[model samples]
Target chain A: MPILWLFLIVLAIAAAGYVIGRSRAVASVGGDHRKMHSLASFYGSNVAIKVFVPAFLFTIAWLLVQPIVVNATVSDMIPEAAIADNSSRGLVMAEVRRIADGLDSAVAAGGMSADFARTPQTDLDDVTQRIKDAGGVVTSDITAPVLNAAQRYRAMNGTGNFIMSGLAILIALGGAWWGIRESHADFRARNTVETSIRALLIGAASIAILTTLGIVLSLIFNTIEFFRLYPAADFFFGTNWAPSFSGRGGSSDLGVLPLLWGTFYISIVALAVAVPIGLFAAIYLSEYASKRVRSVAKPLLEVLAGIPTIVYGLFALLTVGPLLLEIFGKDGLGWMQAGTAVMTAGLVMGIMLIPFVSSLSDDIINAVPQALRDGSYGLGATQSETIKQVVLPAALPGIVGAILLAASRAIGETMIVVLGAGAAARLSLNPFEAMTTVTAKIVSQLTGDADFASPEALVAFALGMTLFVITLALNVLALYIVRKYREQYE
Target chain B: MMKDNADERIGVDAMDIKFAAKDVQVYYADNHAIKDVSVDILDKTVTAFIGPSGCGKSTFLRSLNRMNDTIPICRVEGDIRLDGQDINAPEVDPVQLRAKVGMVFQKPNPFPKSIYDNVAYGPRIHGLARGKAELDEIVEKSLRRAAIWDEVKDRLDAAGTGLSGGQQQRLCIARAVATEPEVLLMDEPCSALDPIATAQVEELIDELRQSYSVIIVTHSMQQAARVSQKTAFFHLGNLVEYGDTTDIFTNPRDTRTESYITGRIG
Candidate 1:
């Protein structure tokens, strides 16, 4: 309640400072030097900001300290015996308060003895009768101290409120005065204001770095815990990835090699489907196609990118799987299964990321200055020859960057893998067979009702850590390649 | 539909005379950039197009090889007869036209490839070389013709972009030469090069007149006087005067040409 009052007083002071500054400026509105920058409101705002900001900070600081100081002083007044138990003191204080309330009611009801009332009674008699009625006896000795402490509490509360609000007003007034005094020539207001803003920007940037560090550390620590019982060699080298070791009768098999194989196999398939098609589309747009063809084709290509990955996952699961199976299923070639497999998901993912790769590669290709294209054309080279021999080579670094970025996204992809890719993790060479990726396993292992303290749950973190490291390296490499590309052109 | 004037052009060029454009109109989107323009370029001669910026000299140069067609919104309506042959025929491929009429830009633009590869690109695309030895000889001969062979002969495997500015421009010329084109066009080729490189390129241009007719666009009036046999003065997208280099400089036919030549106006 006192903090609310102090806040009001501080606000009033700030408003007064703004009015005063604006009026002072208004005096010079007509003919005084004709040199004031910004506007009267901006000056008023500056004054108000100076008056309010420091006072608010100090008030919040004092509020934090007040409770701690009051608690220490109040706790010190308690007897050492009550402090020793620590637990019994709360119950004892409640009992004492109940008796005091009963005594006050008795005095109001005119049921107390005149002699007892005359002495400004200790309320001991009323408590005795009330305790007897309840069939218990908590002595009246704690009652006297309860009355004494309540009286001291109200006084301390008043003093704290007075001092805190008074300090807030004084600080605000002092700030306004200082600001008015410093309003002279050669005072760099913009520099002071921008320095504060620079500090804020730095604070915002540090948060991104810190968040990445925190995630890495968490993955590392949990993965370490997972490695305590399960050996790292078994996790990385063994083929079968059955986490249910208890069901296997002492056979514990959890391997990442199969998952890693699945990840690479799918990524390779995705790249195969994407690169030639994407690069050709990019070249056509950047080199040969007219503006009309490009305008129609470019956004149509980007529509595939706009459809969410989960939709692509559904398409893979419901459509592509069935379609593939019909062609290679029991009814036809009988080489593939009825459910999702590596090819179905990878093809869909490749379709989804085609624009992701192509648009970026297109920009890079287009950015390879028109001068280079002119140089090629002047030499009698055909359009395709020019793009293949000159433009693509110039744009190679940026294309590599775009591909690496897409690959990193693919490696860390969760929704599509979780929905479309199969659950079984086995080291296999066939693209027709169903297989699982690292992301699919992570989602499965983490969301299931496994005990948090066990190695099974902790292994998710280990997988997470491995996934983080791989993607981080891919991103850093992508950044390095992009920077080199920029340096070449710029 | 395109018109074929190759038959007419062959007979006229066999006579060793000048090609002429009667009237040319250039439009960009809907804005008329160049009004009815006419000029003549003589055989075995260096013709200079001199004007202030945006006077459409470069536009006229690009029109010679249908380079204007590369720009989507640009529209050209004109009669440009090269040796009496109307160049814009329906059966005519701009690629072939560009091959026969090569160009060097205002800025030196080298391919980001090896010097050998850069020079060999045009020959490879046009299938002008029969074998490795032939292609090598062609590449070397073109480089020697551009006058950068001694400096870059040993570094043929090095990236073309790694060369100095003057060498890069010569490398561009070599690349153009590898296609075995007939007429060479230069648009402010010395603007981005140093004085020494400019002298070297100018000297090379004089030697090139033995086989290929050359047209140059220059901002410097002194350059036109120094390197050209004939000069065409343009102002506000109009060809104001075109005559012998001596007559254009010493006694211009038009007032605008006179003011520009005398440094009164650009």
Candidate 2:
């Protein structure tokens, strides 16, 4: 196999390079005690690399081009009567291979058939991989001319393979010899390798920028496709959101108002749940907790954050949804539909965000200069007064940025909403009522059977663009607030 | 330098045991910061503490009103008494102590508010003024006392952070003064100011002696000589010398005090 030949050639190259390098190292001493350039091994490796790299590349390129070229040429030689307009070249190639196998099988059995179509198989040194239809000749009564052509063709094929592979190995050995000769003490191989590595790093750095550009452009083009089927005005302003591409005729209207409402409602609920709890917890951890308490509590809360969103989604669906339905189901206080309402998802999401808000705020609070706190305390202010008047105000900007980031995450969240916030898309005032958001609708419209070109499917892109713009705007605002905040202390 | 005790005591007011700290030792997380510091702060005169850094000048300054109690790991042992009542007594509150003895910090720490609110913060918290007009009077009086009333009277609503560095420090001084404390503690208040601001603040401190007992911790010996009536020399947490400012600066009896004042050593 090609793998085995490459391995053997590499070993021989290493040995030759080593011997040549060792000789060069010893000879350059010139009867004096001091040595000349590089070690023998370095010379040998240098020559080996010189010989192997180019020849290996050439052999690989030839191997690829030769097979395709031979296949195409032989494909033309296939029976023209058997081919048709609808027939494929792949099938034709398969037939040629089968025919060659049959010829080989017949020749090995010493029984050449009588249906031989090949008469001058070897005389014309065709470079095609095809063999003269060997199965067509009869064993004892095969035509003389046909037998000679078959043998000659086989000989030519064998000779071509030997030369191609032999040259590949020879070039590899020559490269090893040259690598050894060129090896010297001053070669700076490290710098050469590092320069190439630096180029690779630059290549990697541009990928992040390009990927962002790619996502934006892809969204814009796809959104344009969606607008072709649905009017932009209706998509933006419509109140209902029921997308039925199957044309069943009873489906409700599809608009963004319901999803927007749901996103706002859930986010409000999540903020309601997250802000007080996160802030209070952060205060306790950063200000009140002893070192021992902090050591234990910090990592435990981080573990809560590490639980995957999918697991939270499953918990909402399997546990909370049914439990709430039982408590509120048209019987007991029927004000609630199920536990997996806006409150449920928001509360769970808030719990997940506790560590994020706390850790970020904690760092910002700690970073607030120690002098400010001392100044407040020196003024005879109590611990509570100092924190309320001095530290929190100083840390407010970073906290606002953190809250904005959390809000974006809330808006973009999908799994928990999909499982808990039911498929209903309505402008309802009740938090207990089922609702859907932009991300949930995106998952729904994209997954079900719908044409990619359809307005319904393309609606996801428009939603995506909206989400992107909102998050970007929020990011700018948060950064502005944080920067202004720092300017006060700096 | 050539002053007797009676001449030195010319400006000194009769003391009624206003505030006294006895053998107070402070530790921060088991690291001994101040060891066995004892001092008395009189009613209506400027008392200056001069020392090399880490000699616990500021640490002793914080102990007069129990400000070190705010720091969780900063432990204090020994009694600090105010008006014959122990401040470390179980029922006595640190907040009340701070309200009665306000402080100016080393750096200008004006709150991120309008110049008016920065001055009015302490009064607003303590509910000192009943209405807007009364609060205005308090603000004007505090700013005037700090010698920044004319510079900022026109733009009271401008952000405190918008002021120049010296002005910001004066604003912080006005903030502490607004609380109407009987004793004012200034911890290296001029360390972050220019020489002009330092001179202005020293003039203000001289004027302040008429109303409040001012204990100042300063690095500048010239400042201590100019603004203080009484001087306490601290060396390695010990109150090594205490007497009239002129006497201590000119003819210190202690060898350590002589070496420090003469610039032979710190």
Candidate 3:
């Protein structure tokens, strides 16, 4: 049976249990709700939880385990000689599973008979033709041992699914019976229901944390593997960033220094453009702007954040890069060589981050108590003087945290650098020079047909891990600064 | 209304009036907050305005320094003169007016700076001192005048917000006095403080009457009788009675004033 159908059947059983348990409890209380320990809905939910939780858990576990067990048994059935020269056991097993599914479809499509599909001694070419006629992809001709293994794999999977459905239904029925038996007036249904809800909430919270841990662990393992192939010292300190494919048999120098330098240079340029413009915009919006102006202007400024980064990348590549080139290219100041440079990407990225910095800083500035402003104004200070001396100082730590967050966003940006900053890894001080960041290189290295085990591809994970650590450190520092500043006022 | 001889009423000369207002009216949006209040406040004396909550005493006090100008919907009308000059004239600047008339709010609101810096803020902004030594001298004088110098003298570098409730209120008073204003407007300055702090602030206010004209708004009738020489009683935005504190508390003027002082009505 399909998993969706099985899910629906379990839901139907639980719904039935809910109705029966609610009615039984009411009947046991002689239609007087005051005699019951909990409300009628609580009793219904308790029965539903019992009927659904264990049965669904069992079904999920069986679904996960059946394939692994079936694959192992079927893989053992095929002899070693049956494996092709270019293929391993894993690949052949994949082929067997595909054929097994194809056979089921072929039988359904009436292109092959069920009896012929179950038989192991049939002609391989005839079976392949029938599968093809039924619109199944057959890479090559099937051998006798492979055909037998596919047949056995199919049979075992069918039996496993059949038994799974039966056992799941049995558990649901047993849960229903137990729930009805406990549906007396004195049963503590609300307590059981509340505890189950708390468990469910904890389970949800842990899933999010566990997923983050899993991603970090995977990155760690891959990064360790990369280190074994390439020296950690060279990867860390070397200035060159050149990755030669394994097929070329040439040594590759995969240094992270040039990438880190590029990342920092671009981020600094971006922050230089963003901080003053963003901060001043926030100050004006929060302090000087009228209520009607602010109501319209705040959301309009936030619209900049809602624009996609990829769209910004296109804007850089098509408009901003060329605009910068016209001013500083050979025809003008002779500083830039091409449209794609660190300056181009950095400028566009800064424009993208305006709303991010302004929105956060505006909120922080607005959070500064009105009492402070009143004190300054009461002492005959002008509005500008009051904001400059009192308001800005109080909001400085929070603004710094906002700037750090924007810096992290800048460092991790990929699409803008890919389109605006040319893919040349070099350490230079010139803003007009073409440069590439770690994130852009990661994207380049992971795409295409590079072997996953090669140092070239594995280096992406190392870059990712390094970027993760840097951003994580930045975020922690920002949070610490914000928290320390908050303690002063509260 | 009956007009009595000024010397017979309070034994004070009439020429000592520092602030004279005629037919003052204040509005917040469409709501009239203060209605046709006319009074003369004497210099070198503490005057108190006693009223129930929302009776417009604070509104009248804030208009003295033009603090009501900060609120978008608040509007004030009529003639108010300080030292025989119309303060509401177009040529007069509110900033300079505020420097001449400093205010302390109901709640203690110290700037988030060091105690020295908090006291130095007003003088620094108004260019009252020409050098750092002069600024420091001004800070010390102001803090001493506010009567919190001995308690915080050793910790001038400490954050002003770190002080206790009473100390913070005193620090705010010091900050207000740093500009060396001629008049001080205190709007319920002791409401947020305990009794000890209130008593301390009241003593400071009594001492402040030696040099500057002081106006205070209060809820406690006994507080008015304690710290003020002249008292004005307000009920429902109307000035019900204005006289010496002893006569207002003892003798009957309006039936409403008598009822309020006798705890029959507020």
Q: What is the lDDT of candidate 2?
A: 0.76
The DockQ scores of all candidates, in the order shown, are 0.67, 0.49, 0.69
**For every candidate, how close is chain A to the native chain A in TM-score?**
0.72, 0.65, 0.96
Question: What lDDT tens digits, residue by residue, belong to model 3 across residues B1-266?
Answer: 11232234355544689899889999999999999999899887788999778889999998888888888889999889998888899998989998998899988889888999999998988899999999999999999999999999999999999999999999999999999989999999999999999999999998898788999999888898888878899888888888877778879588988888888876
Error of 3 at A444 (Å): 1.3
Output the lDDT of residue A19, model 1: 77
Question: How many residue pairs of model 3 clash at the backbone?
Answer: 0
Ranking by TM-score: 3, 1, 2
Write model 2 residue lDDT over A1-490, tens digit each, in one string. Answer: 2546765776677667666755664565652323544444544545555665567676778677765655655555555654457766665455445444445665555544324323344332221222333333232222333234334344434444566677777777776656555555445433433554586688788998899989999999999987777877777899989877776323535578899999889888878888778887888888889989988987887787789888888888888767776777567668686666876676667777777788778878878888777767656676788789888988899999889877888888888888878878889998888888898998998996867876777889999988888888888998888887786777
Residue-level lDDT of model 2, residues B119-213, one tens digit each, is 88888888999999999999999999999999999999998989988898899889899999988999999999999998888889878877888
Model 3: clashing residue pairs?
A: none
What lDDT is obtained when candidate 3 is compared to the true structure? 0.90
TM per candidate: 0.80, 0.77, 0.95
Where is the poorest 10-residue window by lDDT in model 2 chain A? A123-132
**Candidate 3 chain B — worst ten consecutive residues by lDDT sum?**
B1-10
Candidate 2 CAPRI grade: acceptable
- What C-alpha root-mean-square deviation, in Å, does candidate 1 show against the real structure? 8.6
Cα RMSD of predicted structure 3? 2.8
